[model samples]
Target: MPSTTGSATAPLRVDARPELTGDRRIAVLLSHGFTGSPASMRPWGEHLAELGYGVRAPLLPGHGTTWQDLNRHTWAQWTATIREVFEELSATHDAVVVGGLSMGGAQVLRLAADVGDRVAGVMVVNPAVSTLRRDVRLLPVLKHVVPSFPAIGNDIKKAGMDESGYQRTPLKAVHSMMRAWPQLIADLPQVTAPLVYFRSATDNVVDDSSEPIILGRVSSTDVTRVPLPESYHVATLDNDAPTIFARSAEFVARVTG
Candidate 1:
């Protein structure tokens, strides 16, 4: 695991109170995808801060370094860091909305399920809970045999946008992420907070399967699904990112009110 829960490289954290919204002090804590650093979520977080909301995008354990480091860390290390960030935000802000990209999205959902109403809302872009790949079933046995494979990051439709994620997919870390999916899918009903889901219409990385599971299962009556017609997996750095930033701010205002 990385020495610090979140290193300072390209970190994004802004403390601001809205001059244009409700009386509640709200903050948005975002998490990056597996093998991804804070760079991916920084732009979105900055946009929220410009709108006068406290924003935080923390680097996960075993990220921002070599793929070998990621393999050494399990899903537990990543989840623990997210849990720590959420608790701190909840203590400081009147309300906190948790969100993320890819695996980061699942981490936030787990927190929402555990903490229930304490999480004001959720905003996920290209979140992955389960995969259609049959090879994944063999991860438990294959992870020891094979260390890693090609990365699933930077699947953007934009011309030159880069997610700056790991070049290799660490088997141990990825297997750990998928291992939590079954339980999370079952606990989806426990997440009752308002949800704003953004998914790229065509993604080479994540399929359309997880969307139905999340949209159908989460008990959030205020669920809103926004399809990114022109983007791919890393929608945060793609053409539709503005829409995500704008709508997410609105979501915060509505739920935190």
Candidate 2:
């Protein structure tokens, strides 16, 4: 059963706990996408936990709450939350693999760049570093007037599946993310950890532009790009979720073993 214990001020979905496995020596920090709660990464975290790996799918600072709350926070708060968790895990774990979906992916990439060889490996699904949309250029001015736009969640091909993310896209928060993009791209060369990238074929949110930018800039020699044919943007809950789980397990073993 999905636990509904969060307050109205911060409504968390069922299965959105900061989970951990019995084995704490090897940890995996899994991050959910922007505007998304830990619910989006819960299934993937649980699967890894079942395999005796430590998993932590933390809810970002402003997320799992109202969209208005997200507008009040910036990308720095979100990254700070993940950095604290990663540092905590890194202190005790012999090896750590950081993985995320969408914006979560970008977060992990930034971590990998900052931490370098300390991160055993990296995995991401539909990671976004840049946008192809022209409207994004207007964000600097539009954000002042527009509180939010349409929601970007539930981009899954699997029918009836919900990611349990925010219902609307907070323009102010989106602008903060945009501000962080250039820095993330600039630091990409610092990331040398083994990377396993999963790209969905029909993603409506993140376009084809992001993947090439990441692959071209990263210094990692061990890089694998897998295609998710059946899934959409949020592939963690989509059809190829099993593939993601299985391949991720293998990727971790190969790099950390």
Best by TM-score: 1
User: Alpha-carbon error at 97 in model 1, in Å?
Assistant: 0.7
lDDT of 2 by residue, 1-257 (tens): 34434432232222212333333367788888888877778778767766667777888878877899999999899899889988978887778899999999999999999999999999999999998899999999999999999999989999987888888999999999989999999999999999999999999989999999999999999999999999999999999999999999889777867
Candidate 1 Cα misplacement greater than 4 A, ranges = 1-9, 18-23
lDDT minimum window of 10 residues, candidate 2 = 8-17
Position 29, candidate 1: lDDT: 94
In order, how many clashes per candidate?
0, 0
Q: Candidate 2: global Cα-lDDT?
A: 0.86
Candidate 1 accuracy as lDDT: 0.86
Measured with C-alpha atoms, the lDDT of residue 182 in candidate 2 is 98
Listed in order, each prediction's TM-score against the native is 0.94, 0.91
> lDDT (0-100) at residue 110 of candidate 2?
94
The CA lDDT at 231 in model 2 is: 96
